[model samples]
Target: MPLHLADLVARSELHLSVVAAPDRLDRPVEAAHASELLRPGQWLQGGELLMTIGLLLPMTEEACRAYVQDCAAAGAGALVLGLGRELPYQEAPAPLIAAAEAAGLPLLTVPDEVPFIAVTKAVFAAKAAEQHRALERVFDAQRRLTAAAASGRGLTATLEAWVDATGIAAAVTDLLGRPIAAAGLDDLDPFGPAGLPPAVTELVHKVAGRGLRGSASSASGSLGSVEVQPLGANRLRGLLVLVGTLAPNDRMPASGLVSLLSLELERRHLADEPERRRRSALLGRLLTEGVSAEHAHDVLAVAGLASDTVRTVAVDPSGTSAEMAAEVAADLALAVPGGLVRVHDGLVEAVVGDNLDLIEILSRFASGAPAGIGPAVPPEAATGSLRQARALVAVSRALGHPAQTREAHSARLLLEFGDRRALRGYADAVLGPLDSADPTGDLVRTLATWLDTGGSWDETSRRLAVHRHTARNRIDKAMRLTGRNLDDGDDRFDLWLATRIRQEMKAPGT
Candidate 1:
């Protein structure tokens, strides 16, 4: 506890008296200063007890009021008057008393027998003792926290010890403001809002972005106090958030706690890196050929995954650069329990057991970014499942849907089996005569447009920027050259398949 005016006056040796409105004696005295200048407040700082005589003060009420007002404005914690020799008055002046009451400053009176040095010595002794006690408390808390961390359950134990010491709730969050660890809160979300509160999350971003340490509080008292400290060096790693009241001295210990927590988190990260790499390689092997089912089952059992059946998800972060999307996917995959994630050929793939909530886990990583999820399949069929997911991703992007699962897009499986050479040969066989007959290629273009427009001649003509009759003639010429009857369902299917095959061949990697 700090030294207050009441604590000073209660000492029997000092023989101090409370002269004017003494209701405010609870104000803490951070320091003690003695000055006889006309305006002693000039040399004073807030939370200080200013002791003086009436030597430089005027007898008039107005002069005394101005003097008291200045002390109050200067944030003087209390005014102590020595009234035996310097000033002939037996008590504090009436105007000074009234002004102190109005300004809510405590006023104390000391006898001439008590030397000024005695009061200063008392304040010094009290402050030193308080400092010693504070240090003791901080050191003890640090020891307990260190013990908790070394006891094998480091993260959770450290957090629980911090709560016991500070009586405050704390949470550790990633750069995305998602909580990775928490204590003293009912839910895993210790921030009190769904996900992270946007205001504090924005602050976390700024701190991580600029390598800054920040503290903010709610004046409305709704959130008490909030402090954010960055983790890691050079680059931002994570953040620590504390929500509660803390004394000025408590802040130092809080910072020390943050440093300890960061070390533990980084230690775990370094320790887990090798395992993460091993799981990634295993997933890669499973997706490729040559890994036997028995060998794969052994690996899956070692990694705590189902050996027989697994589900894989392919995330397509449309419009984002491949590098950034891959990084996010990798992080999410590693975070998921018993899951393996890999990024290849512009897609993020995760292989997990059948019991996981695939949608919820993907949503956490996707965060509104579009993705595609393949159906559950046997371990040997993982490659085919991923291909189906990739095709669905393409279909979803083309149709302007956010995401598509295997059940919603089973037809996309047809796209998985076509050989590039065979597809190209078939396309040429179906459309080769039409291409040779029309030097301008109008017949092929008209046929494509007519098919895309659902065989509506009017819509096809409007899309081609030509008259309806001209479009009709082009279609008739295409049918005659191909020797395919337009009214036959089989011929129409063949024409559509050829156009699709040609389109796929023109794609970048094909």
Candidate 2:
């Protein structure tokens, strides 16, 4: 048992006379420290039972009053005065006792025969015993936590051990503010006024700001108090809060247990982060690489992401590896309850519920790269939707606008007309005006006719009613007009696709 004022008083063998408010005696003497001076402005360390004999001051009433005022200002846990030498030993100086009472400092009268050293020794012995017991409890808690970790027990078991050791309730919440683990009192609500008492909330907010641990007590009448700490690497994980009701008269521990717990939680979280990232990466890779629907489903099941609906999206800036892709994919997966996987380089496939908000989910991925989102189809359509998303991405890249969406049918049009060859042509056509002055009229028309004839000079001549040589001359002239070569493999592919695309536009329903 920790030392209390009553214990100290009994041990000191002093006449137990309570002066002023006797109720203040209930406060614990948490530690053993003695101060004999009377400095008015000096701050008193909490829980210390201060002793004085009035030997340093005059015996006047004003001097006695000033001494009491100093004890109050210092917030001395209790004040013990030795009587009989200068002032009469039988009774406490009235003015001094009155001042001590007014200041709310617990005052104890010591007879001249009772040595102050005896009181200090008794307090010290009691504190030493308390420390030993606290150490035993801490060791027991640590052993249980180690066992739980080795056995792969969930967070709750570890929390339970801590609670049992400290006589406090422990709660672990995720970044989303949901409790993932808790132990001890079930009636402790975290959301209500009674649950997250004002002092605890203030302490949590303060700790959050500094990325450190903090604690606070409720108003004097509240049931219990709390301590809040940020746990995990980079403090990305949520908080761990410990709530407890301490015996009003028992000494509070001063051995930095709260700080130690914060370090332990952070260490564990850091150890787990790499493995979590690895698993997320594996899930992402399996989804993005065009895996069969059944295979993808198996992978999702393995990753604990089995869902009935999915949406596929293709991302650009293709150098992103599986790991980087996975992080983004995980964020998307968390945005919704269902599982998400990566299907290919820069492509993420997510199996989300029907009610999942598409805009918010996609927006998170968009922050990382230029992305083309396919329709939010069901899981059965994942493969097809992934292909559609790829097609949409191709169109976006070809048109130099990375995320625009045309009508629903636009994907099909781009799929049919925006192949790699078509993109080269579009690039040329768009770039042609920069290369030559009359590209729009001359180069575009000749290119169109040649494509209409299927790249054959004789056929093109027949369609245009010109000689083969003349048709060849027109084609060559058009390439020159666009400042490009028609015969080069890259140039030919570009011209052919661009010409065909332009002709298609002239046809109905372009």
Worst 10 residues of 2 by lDDT: 248-257
Q: Give each model a TM-score.
A: 0.63, 0.54
Model 1 pairs in collision: none
> Residue-wise lDDT of candidate 2 within 1-510, one digit each (tens)?
666787765653655556655778777786545555657336566677776676665656777778877766666677777666554355666777777777777888777676677777777778888888777765666666666544556566667666665677767654333456677857655445344555555555555444434434443224355656676443334567666664432223312333334455555655656655655565455545556667766765766666666666666645666666655565454445545544454565544545655554454344435566666665546657766767677665554444423423533355444564665566556546634655446446655677756687777777767788876776677666666775677766666556555555556875
TM-score of 1: 0.63
- Residue pairs with colliding backbones in model 2 are 44-74, 84-89, 284-342, 287-342, 287-343, 288-342, 288-343, 288-344, 289-343, 289-344
Instruction: Specify the highest-lDDT model's number.
Output: 1
Q: Least accurate stretch of 10 residues (summed lDDT) in model 1?
A: 406-415
lDDT of each: 0.74, 0.59
Report the number of backbone clashes for model 1. 0
- How far out, in Å, is residue 244 in model 1? 2.2
- lDDT per residue for candidate 1 within 1-510, as digits (tens), equals 778888988998988888776888888888888987778777887988888877778867788778888888899988888878655667778877887787777888888888778888888889899899988888888888888878888677888888888787777887666778878765434356575576667666556555434544442235556767776543345678777777776676687777778788667666876776788788887777756777767767777776578777777766778766655565565456778877777777778887866666565456555566677788777777777777667655554443446435322334444455776788899999987888787887889889878999899989999999999998898888899987999999889777766665666875
What is the overall TM-score of model 2 with all chains considered together? Answer: 0.54
